[model samples]
Target chain A: MPVRVAVDAMGGDHAPGVVVEGALEAVAEAGDRLAVLLVGREAEIRAEVENRGGAEDDRLRVVDAPEVIGMGEAATEALKRKPDSSIHRGIGAVKAGRADAFASAGNTGAVMAAALFGLGRLPGVLRPALPGYLPTPTGTCVLLDVGANVEVRPEHLVQFARMGAVFGEFFLDREDPTVGLVNVGEEPGKGTDTVKEVYEALRALGDRGAIHFVGNVEGRDILRHGADVCVCDGFVGNVVLKLAESVSTILPDLVRAEIGRQGLGADHARTVGGVLRGMLAPFDYQAHGGVPMLGIDGTVVIGHGGSTARAIRQMVLSAARLVEQNLTSRIARALADDDAPPHP
Target chain B: MPVRVAVDAMGGDHAPGVVVEGALEAVAEAGDRLAVLLVGREAEIRAEVENRGGAEDDRLRVVDAPEVIGMGEAATEALKRKPDSSIHRGIGAVKAGRADAFASAGNTGAVMAAALFGLGRLPGVLRPALPGYLPTPTGTCVLLDVGANVEVRPEHLVQFARMGAVFGEFFLDREDPTVGLVNVGEEPGKGTDTVKEVYEALRALGDRGAIHFVGNVEGRDILRHGADVCVCDGFVGNVVLKLAESVSTILPDLVRAEIGRQGLGADHARTVGGVLRGMLAPFDYQAHGGVPMLGIDGTVVIGHGGSTARAIRQMVLSAARLVEQNLTSRIARALADDDAPPHP
Candidate 1:
């Protein structure tokens, strides 16, 4: 059976239009193995789908969601107020077995709230983390708690490491993913007390074959691909993500301007832009469509509130892949074992 | 009435060679307005200084110090053992009223340790902070505690903000330096409890017209001249510094490589390198020689351990500038009456 992905069609920056286009492209690329459920104002989505001259096939379906959660609204508040919102309805589809996984480029907080409230968390999972993939010279690395949990305890970091490990193993297909505690330095005594404790815990866990712990790594190490999973508090993770994004944005522009002065002409400029974009594109989470709220019982990927149609489509494609890979269940199984002792 | 600076002749990566050359350049540039005391092994320094074939003047003096501090040696331990080290001797000259300020491209920890032990901290300064000037598109911004105190409290952050504000006002000559707390987001309730408390404290302090507090700014804001003085704990500050350096290094290479593929010749490549280097070079703190340890009673600037003679010379020039500006005393005066209520 093909993997079914439920997308909140009315959500994101270019909702319905970009989302529909992205879905068409995703379906075409995914062949017959993927199915998309565009859950939003059915008439509008149907009109857009039909206007594009793409035939309605068994792999594509339109489900109605009358309401929408605004990007500016609080996640929990929006979820409670707008129960019939497109994102909520889409998650409900996953819960009701109509779709295998749900993805939405709506309010992140709302999607997270809906996923946790609707699908619930996995056993032994204290909090669901937003693990983002950072592209490095070697390959892609994961940085957990990109913005999901504001205040995470030391135990939360430990759990994030575990879940992130599973993500790298499944998504990026790495064996024994190297995990590192993101700190100021590589020294054991470096960073806040919370990080220090987490470092010890991670080391102990690694000894038991939970993950390949690489000890403390610095910010430079994140881009150097020093570790497969970089674990930190939500605050630090968010800072790192934003910093990387800013650098990626500014550096390319500076380079382009510098190159333009030499009269390399249009062809050279476009080539440089394309190469820079390809290198930095992975950091743009919008292009990835959504960030997976890992460690939940069911598959849920939360997209950026400012996401466009292409972003929404990517979210749908990612959700479908997560379902096919059985990522959630695999993460749950990894955390269920309680044989390891707590490190002092 | 002219400012005098003591340069550690036997310090840094390319010591004696680069240091000797840079000092000659500094002395020649300043002319009769500045006096530079070269502190190291008298014979070697004098030989290097004389070999440069410059007119002999009373403005430049070679102070004898038989010992040298190895960059790899433990900071405090090295200082304790080598009482006659060039860095220690240079500070002694400042304490003894022979030089206004001391600059060295030696061990940073040793410089801090020596500054504290030799020169002492200002009246209410809890700890001396290493303040780094980061170049931005708008201009330059000062970030304090780049690598001074690892474990910091809310109170420490408050003090750093104060010191950085004073430094900015005096050195950068900003009338009211806008101080910003570097956090994950601009939202009031976004960061960790520590950051939240610091934010409130900064707000309270800013309300009193003591400093222009710009509330919370994100990581991206750091490089955009968002605030005149961006304050954070040493751990976070160090991360920011290292990340900036890594990006400056990696991005140019990536750009050059991509441009090379378009058959851009060696001349064009060199031109690209020159332009990018000019823009990114200012952000490389290592090239700037050393960072000043603000809040100390006397002037102490710690240069990179791998700093060459060029860096050492720059450190000497920077130290002279700080002394002329009366950086330490000015910061002390500003922080003297800061008894405002702690932020909630």
Candidate 2:
């Protein structure tokens, strides 16, 4: 059976245009194996589809979602105020089982709020979290609670560890991914009271074979890929993600300014800039695509507001993979067996 | 009178060699206006001074500090165990009025612990914090509590702002430097429970003209230079600082890898790498020198463990400036009347 995906076409900075093109691309690539419900203003989506000249696919259906919640709107107020918004309607499809997964590049808060209220949390989960995919030199690592629970208890962190590990296994396609608690130091007794408690809990969880908890990791560890899954409170995680996102822009600007300062000719500068961009390709958000709201009862991925057509296409594929992998059930089972004694 | 500065010659990775060279440079430049007390193993300090030639400077004195504290040792325990360590002796010089200021490139925790116990806190200060200098496109911004006070309250953050502002004014040489609270979102209401309270306190303080509080700033603000001083609890600040420090190394490596992948000739790669290194000069900790532990009763600066001769020289010069400007008194006065109504 085809795994149907709902796309928030009205969401994102370049909404409808890139979203439509991306949905069309996913439908074309996946053929009959995947079906996309483009949820947004039908007229705008149709116009975008027509502009792209690929409107004849049966697998791609434009489902009318008249309202549009802005990128900066308050999640709860916007969702309650605009019931027909793309984020709401898109998530509604997942809740109703019309679509196996939901994806959006809209307001991250709204997407998360919608997922929580509509899909609810999986069993054995304390709090849901947004896991941002960071591209390290070694490959990719997951930094969770990127914008979810701003204040998390020790138990919430333990839950994040289990969920993050499962997601890491799928994303990295590696067994026994290492989980780390992001802190000021790598020692066991480091960090705030909450982090200390979480560290011990994670240690206990590791001993039980539920996860490969690799002690504590500092901020540099994220880029160093010291652990496959790095977890922290949403407040810290969000700040780190934003800073990392800005590095792509800041680093290149510094390089360009340097080239100018060195009095390099325009021709040489162009070649150097090209090489620099190629080198920084790994930092591209479009390549990483969407971040999944882990612990949700169903698959729900949130992309950057400035997502390109390529990013949207990648998010759609990622959603399909999560569905096929039965992420929610796997996470539930992992948490359920967390306390059982290790098999002999 | 000349400003007397105590240098922790046994601290940092390079130890006596770089410390001696840097001290000599500072003394030579400052001439009779500066005096340096090199606190470490007397024999080792003398050997390094002789190895570098120019050992006839009368302003540089070698003070014997027989004991040493390893960087990885527990801060409080090490400080107690190694009473004769360079960090302890350096701060002792400042406390005893033999030195006007103290500087160290040793274990950061050890330096902070020694400063707190030795010099105590300025009047009205809630807690002392470490302010890390970050180079931006415009100039430098200070991020405080970089590794001190990992868990802080609203009042502590307010104190940080007042102290950081005083430091920023001197460091940036700009009157009324802007102070920003590092948080997940730019909105005042966004962040953890502690941050929300801090927002209100900072706002009230700003309204009274205690500081030029710029509401909230995200992680990107450090490089964006959104504010002259960005404040956060030590836990978050330390993480951000370390991650930013890693970028210098990571970015250069990525460029080299890209050059190799592009099949660029070795000659071309070397030239490009040189240009890249020059471009990244601002990020060099050596140029920024030491991070001052603010709110302390005396001027105490801590340098990176991997500091070079240039960085040590800068730290010594920085300590002189702090003493000359009476930074401790300025911060003390800033927080003393923080609650007083605005002048008519």
Write the residue-wise lDDT of candidate 1 on B1-344 in tens digits. Answer: 66788888888777877888888887877777678888999988888877888544588888999999987677778988999999889999999999998888776777888889998889888888888777776677888878788778888899899888888886577899899988977878667788899888888898888789998879877877779899988877887777766776676656665566556677655555565675675666645677789888898877876676566667777788888777877887877774653223
Ten contiguous residues minimizing lDDT sum, candidate 1 chain B: B335-344
The residue-by-residue lDDT of candidate 1 on A80-101, one tens digit each, is 8888889888989999999898
- Write model 2 residue lDDT over A243-276, tens digit each, in one string: 8777878877788788878888876777688788
Q: Each model's interface RMSD (Å)?
A: 2.9, 1.1
Taking the tens digit of each residue's C-alpha lDDT, what string does model 2 give over B1-344? Answer: 78999999988899888889999999989888899999999998989988888564558888899999988999999998888898888899999999999999999999998899899998767799999877787788889888899988788887888889999999889999999999988887899988999898888888878889998999767778889999999998999988887878787778877897889887678668877888788888898689788999999988889889999999999999898999989888877773732221
Question: What are the models' TM-scores?
Answer: 0.89, 0.96
Instruction: List ranges where model 1 is wrong by over 4 Å.
Output: A41-47, A50-58, A207-209, A256-287, A337-344, B40-58, B62-69, B74-84, B260-275, B278-287, B338-344
Superpose all Cα atoms of candidate 2 onto the true structure and report the RMSD in Å to 1 decimal.
Answer: 2.4
Measured by C-alpha RMSD in angstroms, how accurate is candidate 1?
3.3
The models' CA-based lDDT, in order, is 0.80, 0.87
DockQ for each candidate? 0.42, 0.73
